[model samples]
Target: MRSGIVAIVGRPNVGKSSLLNALVGQKVSITAPKPQTTRHRIQGVLHGDNAQIVFVDTPGMHRAAKKALNKAMNDAASNSLHYVDLALFVIEAGRWTDEDEAVLERLKSVKSPVALVINKVDKFSDKNDLLPLMEKLAPLREWAFVMPLSALKGANVNVLAKQLMERMPEGPPLYPEGQVVGHDLSFTISEMVREKLMRSLAQELPYALTVETEAVEREGGLLKASAIIWVERDGQKKIVIGEDGAMLKRVGTAARRELEEMTGGKVFLKLWVRVKEGWTDDPKALSRFGYEGG
Candidate 1:
């Protein structure tokens, strides 16, 4: 069987997370339109008949300010390039920016062959409209294959998966069949809750928030879970809770419905917000929030 790690690296908001979700044919990673929406290396395992593709979806690489968490995120995205079997360098087909080109340059040091996955093709009227932009990126195109696909619409997604597999090294299966991802049901449930909160909250608010699964109990044909919504400030906590706790209720209810559907068990979602000043800057806090390194 052909199996290996395929790293998806790109700048923020270029549909990197969306592409991973599409490849797995499931909502493995949470997605939002905002930049830096993904802050961790989420692994989505794709098990086919003869192959197992372990897709490592990294956070968007960008220039960061003082915070160690910001630096860690950028470093994590770049470090993901090392030792991968293949690199899927995702980009926005509608527009090409210098920042995108800058990120592509870093991929040069990657040991694996890079494949360009041009996402959001549905935005264009036709392929012809993208030819000019494609021509501009043609120099790097020689080093990789260009795949025009829309992650949201699943257009040409199968084709992209087929091509990506062709580049993977032949080996034993990395993961068992019928397993869609490496993460467990509890971790995924928390991620979904975080995703909904991330999509709904303001940019600054989402950054400060982190979701943790406090408890999971299965009884009487149902699963009940308690989750905590963490924020860095009391005011941010108030906003997340909202007037009469409307916002928290919305996040909890949406998350519970998805849990019940995916897990086939009823859920009791509990949400509480606590203010932890400068959690992102604290090394201990970052590690607790799923970060690997210092």
Candidate 2:
């Protein structure tokens, strides 16, 4: 059987997470239209009849502010390329920009083979519309493969999967058959809550907010979970709570619904919002939030 790690590297909102979900046929990672939605390296396992592909879904690569947290997130995306069997260099097929070329230039240092997987092909009106995109990428003649796919539509995903297998060496599965993800159960739950909040909240609020699963315990036939919503200012905390505690209640209900689905049991969820001034820039706060390698 063939087995190896495939790093999905690209800019934000390019359907990187959508591609991961499509490959695994499950929601193993959180997705958002917002940039830098992914702050951690989430490993999603794709199991075939004989082969297993471990997909490392990383945060988007971009120039960051001087903040340590931003630097760490950007570094994590690049560091993923250091020791991978193949790099699934994703790009949007509907558009071509200098940033795409810059991304290609930066990845040239990697010794492993690179597969240029052009995503969002469904946006093209016809095959002819894709010609320009292919033309722009013609400089990368040495790429292992230039593939077009629609992660949103699951078009040609199997083709990309087959190519990934060809790029990997024969080996045993990296994870067990039933194991499809690498995020801790608690961490996954927290991220789901964050995704819900991101969907419900306004701009800048989602980025300012951080979700943490504070307590999880088994209670007879149900699971008990408590989460903390960290904000940088008191006003933000009040805003998350809403009038008459309606917003917090909504967040709790949403999180519990997801937790029940994940654990296959009823969940009693509790959510609390706390203010931690400038937590994003605070070193101690960064560590607490799992932003390492700063």
Candidate 3:
């Protein structure tokens, strides 16, 4: 059997997380329209008949500011390229940008074979346009394979998966058959809460919010979970809590329902919003939010 790790590297909103979900056949990472929605290196394991591919979904590589959090995120994305069997350099179909070039430059340092993945092919009108796009990108670097696929529509994804498996070195499976992700229950629960908040809140609020699963306990036939939502300011906290606590209630309800389905049992979730001024820029605060390696 073949087994190895494949790092999906790309610019923001290029559908790296979507590709991971499609390959794994489940949602192991949270995806949103906003750039930098993913803050950590999420590993999703795909178990095949004779091989297992562990996909590392990373934050979007972008031009970084001086903020510690931003630096840490860029570091996370770049670091994922090292120590991997293969790298899938994903780019949006029909277009190329400076940020995409930056991602390509970063991949140059990695010794692993890079596969040029042109995602979102379903957005193109005429299929013939892909040939010119591929020709334009081909000179940037030598690739193991150039594939055009739609992560959202799952077009050609299976073919890409088979090619990737064939390239991986022969070894035993790294993870059990039933396991899908590398993170624990608490991290998944916290991410679920953050996803709900990201979907419900305004554009500005999503970046300012972070969730922590404070406590999780088993109570008879149900699972009890307590979480805290950290905001950067008092006004942001109020916005998250909403007038008369309407917004927080909505987020909690949505999280609980998904948690119940994920855990296969009832979930009792408690959510609270707290203010932690300038958490994003502060190194200590960013670490508390799980942003490390700056």
Candidate 4:
């Protein structure tokens, strides 16, 4: 059977996580509108009749400051390019920026074949314009394949999956046929909570906060899970909690509903917001939050 690792690399919000979910037909990675929503290397597995493809969704490649967490995220993305058998270089259709160029530069040294994936093509008004965009991008690197598709709309995503599956090397499947992801249940559940919290908050809170599942216990048919939401400051914590803790209640409700659907069981979710100053810049704290350096 054809099976191998493929890394999805791109600038933030270019739909890399969405593409992984689309390819695997499941949510292996949590996504938000904000940049750097993905901080770890998430693996999404796609199983076919005769082949299996393991797609690694990396953190978005972006210019980092001297912050330890930022560097770790950048390292995680760059490291993904090295270990994979194939790399999908995702970019927004009809758009190219220095960050995209920066990602391409990192791919230059990798031995794997790079496939240029032009995502979000459903936004394009004129389909004919893609030829010029492809022409403009091809000169920069000799791409193994240039595919334009919309990860959100599922347009041409199946074609992209077929092409990647054909490129897989002949080997045993890295993961079992029924397995669709590499993350643990608790990890994915906490991520779901974080996703809901991130979507509920303002622009600044999402970056300052991170969620961790403290405990998951089975009480008969329901799963009782407790999660802690860490923020950088007490003020941020207050904001997250809102007046009479309404914000937290809403976030928890939304998260619990999604978690129930994902796990196929009733969930009793409890969330607590705490302040931990400078956690993002501290390497030890970042590691505690699963942003360990590559």
Q: Which stretches of candidate 4 lie over 4 Å from their true place?
A: none
CA displacement after TM-score superposition, residue 188 of candidate 2 (Å): 0.8
Worst 10 residues of 3 by lDDT: 285-294
Worst 10 residues of 2 by lDDT: 61-70
Can you rank all candidates by lDDT, best first?
3, 4, 2, 1
Q: Could you tell me which residue pairs clash in candidate 3?
A: none
> For candidate 4, what is the TM-score?
0.97
**What is the TM-score (0 to 1) of candidate 3?**
0.96
Per-residue lDDT, model 3, residue 161, is 91
- Please write out the lDDT profile of model 3 over residues 171-290, one tens digit for every residue: 999899889988988888899989888888877788887888899999998999899999999999988999999999999999899888888899999998898888888888888778
Estimate TM-scores for all models. Answer: 0.95, 0.94, 0.96, 0.97
Give residue 201's error in model 2 in angstroms. Answer: 1.5
Please provide the root mean square deviation of candidate 2 (C-alpha atoms, Å).
1.6
Candidate 4 lDDT by residue in tens digits, 1-294: 889999999999999999999999988898898888888899989999999998999989899656787798888988887768899999999899999999888888989899999999999889998878888998888889999999999999999889988888999989977999898978987889888877888777787888989999999989999999999998999999999999999999998998889889899999999889999898889888888472
lDDT of 2 by residue, 1-294 (tens): 989999999876677888999999888888877877888888999888778889999887766556766777777788899889989888898776665666788788988888888899998879788888788786774788899999999999988887787777899999998888888777987898898888778888987878888888888988887889999999999889999999888877887787788778988888889998888877788888887573
Off by over 4 Å in 2: none
Q: Which ranges of candidate 1 are over 4 A from the true structure?
A: none
RMSD of 3: 1.3
Q: Count the clashes in each prediction.
A: 0, 0, 0, 0
